[model samples]
Target: MDLHYTDAQNAFRQEVRTWLAGNVPAKRLPSFDTEEGFEAHRAWERKLKEGNWGMVTWPKEYGGRGCDLIEWLIFEEEYFAANAPGRVSQNGIFLLGPTLMEYGTDAQKARYLPAMASGDEIWAQAWSEPGAGSDMAAIRTKAVREGDTYVINGQKIWSSRAVFADWCFGLFRTDPDSARHKGLSMILLPLNSPGVTIRPIAQLDGDPGFAEIFFDDVRVPSENLLGPEHGGWGVAMATAGFERGLMLRSPARFQRTAEKLLALYRENEDTASPATRAAVTQAWMDAQAYCYSTYMTASKLMNGGAVGPETSCNKVFWSELDRAMHRAALSLSGAAAELDAPWLDGYMFSLAGPIYAGANEIQRNIVAERVLGMPRG
Candidate 1:
C-alpha cells in the first residue's frame, strides 16, 4: 500500500488546516446536550455551511465542496487537531446522510439534505430499544401505514441527541407478521409531532446526551419511508456500515485525545507512574494504527470497493483504546480526579464506547463468525 499523499491531497490538507485555524472557536462551545448549547452548535454548523465545509464528501449541490473520501479524512484530522467543539449534527451528516445518498428518492434527498447540511434539522438516531439495544433484529417498534400516512406506536431508548434534535430516523415493524430483521421500514419522524414524547436520560456528565422516545399514534407522511417498505434491512445495514466503519469514530479523535493525555503526563511526570507512561505510549501507537487502517479503508472505498463486517473489528479496537487512554489520564489525576477533572468525565464516557456501538462481545463474535468463517454454536 502506497501510503503517501499525492500533491493534490497535500494541498487539500493545507486548505483544511488553514480554514480550521481561522474558523474554529477561540473558546469551546457548551456541551450540545443543553438547550443553550444546542443553539450554539447549530450556529456553528451554519458557520460551517457558510464556508461550504458542512460535509465535504457530499456533492456540491448539497452544500458541500464535493471532496473525495481522502479529502474528508484530511478534514477530520484538521477538525480534531484544532480541538473544535463536537459535531452536534454528526448523526445527520455522518450516518443518515450517507444512507440517503444511497437509497433515498430524489424528492427525499431534495427535501432533507440541504436542511441537514445547514444544521437546520439536527438528527437523532432511534435505533436502540430496551429489549433490542444490541440485537437490532429484535426491534419491536411498529409503524402501520394507512392511506398516505404511517402511524407509529412504540418506544426507543438510548437515542443519541434525541433531547434536542429536530428529526430522527429509525426502523419500525411495518409488517407485524414478519420476524427478525424482516418486514421493517426505515422512517424519518419529526420529533415535535403530536403523540411523540421525548424523555432525556442523563449520563455520567449529568447531561441528556441520550433519550428515551415514545410514540403513540405518531403519524408522518408515508413518503418519509426510506428504501422499500418491508425491504428496509438493506438500507439499515448500509447505515450501520457507515456508523461502524469510519464516520462515527474517526482516527483523528483518538489521536487528539492521546496527544492531550501525553501532554498531561509531561506536565506532571513526577506524579506519573512508569506503567502509565507505557500505557500512554501504547495508546498513541494504537491511534496511529487506526489512522493508517482507516486510510487503507478510505482508499479501498474510493476505488469502489465495499465496506464489510470487518468494521466490527475496528470498532472494538478503538473503543478499548479510548478506555485505556482515559483510564491512564484519570490515574494521573490522583486526588484531583475526584474534583470533577476533565479526564474523569472522559473516562466515564469511554466506558460506554464498548457498549454503545454494539457491545464489544457481540463484535468479537461477528469477527469470529463472519470474518474468520467460524460457525455459530
Candidate 2:
C-alpha cells in the first residue's frame, strides 16, 4: 500500500535518468511510432545492450543485470521518459524470454537468451486466427508429431512482427481430438523452416506490422515443446499474465506516457477548449490510477504473491486509456488529424490496443467470472 520510493530507489532513478540522457538518440525517438520504426529501435537496443540494460530482471547468467523488479521499473520509466525508441526485440525480450525463463530447458535458455539480449534474433507471437480472434483457445493451427519432428499445418493470422521476424512462439493443437483448451501445446518454430510462408498485413498506420503465417507441413523439433504437451494452456496463461502485466507495459512505463500527454496538453492548451481540457484532465487522472494499480501489483510480486487473473484488469484499463489519450490528441489536432499529425498516427495505433494482447471485451468477461465471482455466459 505504501507507494513511496526509498532513497536508494530515488538514486537508482537518477542513475537511469543520467544514463538515458547520454545514450538515447533524439532522432530515434519516433521509431516506435510504426512497424518500420523498429529498425531504429534495433539500433537503440544495441546501445542498451552495450550498457547491460537489456531485460534487467533476467538472471545474470543470461546477460541481464540481475536487478530487482523495482529497479527494472525505474529503468523502464526513465527509458520511456527519455523518448527512446521501443525495444526492437520486444517479443523476444518481454514475452518469449520470460516464457523461456519459466518453462524452457537450460539449453533453450543458452541458445536464445544471449542472442535475444544482443538483438541478433527477433521473435514474434503467433496467436489469433481468422476464426479465433478473441477466443484464443479456439486456435486451429495443428501440429502433428511425425517421427522426430512436428509437422505444423494451419494458418495463424494477426501474427505481429512475423513478417520480418526470424522466430515464432505460440500455441498449437498437438491433439486435435481433444476438445476446448485441452491438447494445446506451446511450440517454437523457426521462420526459415521449409513450407512456411509469411504474408504481411497492413494496418491503419500503413505498416505491415501484423502478418499471416501459413505453415504447410513445416517441420520442427519435438524438443521445442514448452512444458508438458497438453499442459500448454497453463503455460500460455502464464505467458498471458506477463503479456498484460509487468512484462509488457509496466506501471512506471505508463507514467512516462502520462507525463508526455500532460506536457503536450500544457503546450497546446491555447488552442484547446473547455471540453478538451476536461478530457485531458480525465486522461491524466486515469493514467495516475494506472500507476497506483501497477505499484500494488509490483508490491505483490516483490512479496511473493502470485499475479493471478486480476492482472487482466490492469491490461484493460491502460490499453483503453492509451486509446482515449490518443483520441483526445487527434481531436486537439482538428483538421490536421489526418495530415500525419504525430498524434494522428498515435490515435490510429491506439485503436489496435484493445484488440491486441487480448481484446478488452474478453478481459471484461474474465474479470466478471474470475475476479467478481459472477456467473459465466
Candidate 3:
C-alpha cells in the first residue's frame, strides 16, 4: 500500500481542514446524552449536511460527496483535529447507513437516507435484549406479521441513544416456531409509535446514554422490514460488521487520543518514570499501527474485498488501545485525574469499548476461529 497521498487527496484534506476551522464551534457543546445536548448535536449534523460532510462515503443522492473510504478517513482526521462536536446521529450514519446502502430497498433508501444524513431523524440500535447481548442470535423479541403491518412485542435493553432517538432498527423473531439464529428479521420502526415505551438507562456519569425499550404490540408497515424476511441473521451480521469495523470506530479518533496522551506525558515528563515513558510510546505506536492497518483495509475494500470476521480483530485492538491510552492519561494525572473532567469522562467511556460492538472476548473468539482457521472447541 502506498503511504503517500496524491495531489487530489492533499487538496481534499486542505478543503476539509479549512471548512472545519471556520465551522467548528469555538466552545465544545454539552454532552449529547442530555435532551438539550441531543438537539444541539442534531443541529451540528445539519451543519455537516450543509457542508456535504455528513457521510462523505455515501453516494451524492444521499447528501454526501460520493467520496471513497480513504477520503472519509482524511475527513475524520481533520474533524477530530478540529475537536468537532461528537456525532449525535452516529447510530444512524455509522452503523445503519452502510447497512441500508447494502441491503435496503430503493424505496427504503429514498425514505431514510436523506433524513438520516440531515439529522431530521436520529436512530438507535435495539439489538441487545435482557438475555441477548453478545450472543445476539439468542434474541427473543417477536414481530408477528399482520397483513400489511407487523405487531412487535418484546423488550430491548442497553439501546444506545434510544431515550431521545426518533427511530430504531433491530432484530426480532418473525417465526415463533424457529429457534436461535433462524426465522429472525430486521425491522425499523418509529420510536414514538403507540405502545412503545422508552426508559432511560443512566451511565456512570448519570447521563441517559442508553435506554430500555418496551414494545407492546407496536405496529409498523411491512415496508419497514430491512433485507429479506427470516433472512435477517445475515443482514444483522452485516450491520455488526460495520459496527465492529471501519465506520463505528475510525483510527483518527485513537490517533487524536494518542496525541493527547503524548502531550499529557510531556506535561509530567520531569516526574515520569521509564515505565511510564515506555507505556506512552507504546500507545502512540499502537495508534499509528491501527491507522496503517485501517488504510490497508480500506484499500482492499476499494478493490472489491468485503469486510468480514477479521473486523473482529480490529475491534479488539482499537478498544483495548483506547482503554490503555485513557488509563495512561489518568495515571499521569495522579490525584488530579478525577478533577480532569474530559480525561475522566473519556476513561469511563473507554471502559465500555471492550464490551460494546461485541465484547473483546467474543471478538477474540472470532479471530481465533474464523481468521486463524482454528478449531471452535
Candidate 4:
C-alpha cells in the first residue's frame, strides 16, 4: 500500500479541514445521553447534512458525497482533529445504513437511506436481550407474522441510544420453533409505536447512554423486515461486522487519544515512571498500527474483498488499544486523573470497549473458530 496520499486526496483533506475549522462548535457539546445534549447533537447532524458531509461514502441521492472508504477515513481523521460533536446518529449512519444498502430492497433503500443520512431518523440497536447478551442466537424476542404485519413481543436490554432514538433495528425470532441462529429476521420498528416502552439505563456518568425496550405486541409492517425472512442471522451478522470492524470505531479516534496520551506524558516526563513512559510509547505505536491496518483493509475492500471473521481481529485490537491508551493517560495524570474530566470520562467509557460490539471473549472465539480454522472447544 502506498504510504503517500495522491494530490487529489491531499486536496480533499484540506477541503475537509477548512470546512471543519469554520463550522465546528467553538465549545464541546454535552453528552448525547441527556435530552438537551441529544437535541444539540441532532442539530449538529443536521448541520452536517446541510454540508453534505453526513455519510461521505453514501450515494448522492442518499444525501452523501458518494466518496469511497479511503475518503471516509480521511473525513474521520479531519472530524476528530476538529473536535466535532459526537455523532448522535452513528447507529443509523454507520451500522444500519451500510446494512440497509446491502440487504434492503430498492424500496427499502429509498425509504430509509435518505432519512438516515439527513438525521431525520436516529436509530438504536436492539440486539441484546435479557437472555441473549453476547449469545445473539439465544434471542427470545418473537415477531409473529400476521397478514401484512409482524407482531413483536419481547424485551431488549442495553440498547444503545434507544432512550432518544426514533427507530430501532433488531433480530427477532420469526419461527416459533427455531433455536439458536436459525429462524430469525431483522426487523425495523419505530420507537413511538404503541406498546413500545423505553426505560433508560443510566451509565456510570448518570446519563441514559442506553435503555431497556419492552415490546408488547407491537405491530410493524412486514416491509420493515430487513432481509429475507428467517435469514436474518446473516443480515444481523453483517451489521455486527460493521460494529466490530471499521465503521463504528474508526482508527482516527484512537489516534487522537494516543496523541493526547503522548502529550500528557510529555507534560510530566520528569516524574513519569519508566513503565508509564513505555506504555505511552506502546499506545502511540498501537494506534499507528491500527490506522495502517485499517488502510490495508480499506484497500482490500475497495478491491472487492469482503469484511469477514478477520474483522474480529480488528475489533479486539482497537478495543483493547483504546482501553490501554486511556489507562496510560490516567497513569500519567496521577491523582489529577480523577479530576480530569476528559481522561476520566474516556477511561470509564473504554471499560465498555471489551464488552460492547460483541464481547472481546466472543470475538476471540470467532477468530479461533472462523479465522484460524480451529475446532470449537
In order of appearance, the predictions have TM-scores of 0.98, 0.95, 0.99, 0.99
Off by over 4 Å in 1: none
lDDT per residue (tens digit) for residues 215-302 in model 3: 9989999999999999999999999898888889899999999999999999999987888789899999999999998999899999
User: Which candidate order results from sorting by lDDT in descending order?
Assistant: 3, 4, 1, 2
lDDT of 1: 0.91
How many pairs in model 3 have backbone atoms within 3 A of each other, for residues 3 or more apart or on separate chains, i.e. clashes?
0
Clashes (N, CA, C under 3 Å) per candidate: 0, 0, 0, 0
What is candidate 2's local distance difference test score?
A: 0.83
Looking at model 4, residue 169 earns an lDDT score of: 95
- Report RMSD (Å) for each prediction in the order shown: 1.1, 1.8, 0.9, 0.9
Better of 1 and 4 by TM-score: 4
TM-score of 4: 0.99
Q: How accurate is candidate 3 locally (lDDT)?
A: 0.93
TM-score of 1: 0.98
Residue-level error in angstroms, candidate 2, position 54: 0.9
Per-residue CA lDDT of candidate 2, range 177-279, in tens?
A: 9877999999988898999999988877667888899999899999999888878888888889998876787765556666676777787889988887887
Model 4 lowest lDDT segment of ten = 331-340
lDDT measured at residue 1 in model 2 versus the true structure, 0 to 100: 58
Lowest summed lDDT window (length 10), candidate 1: 337-346
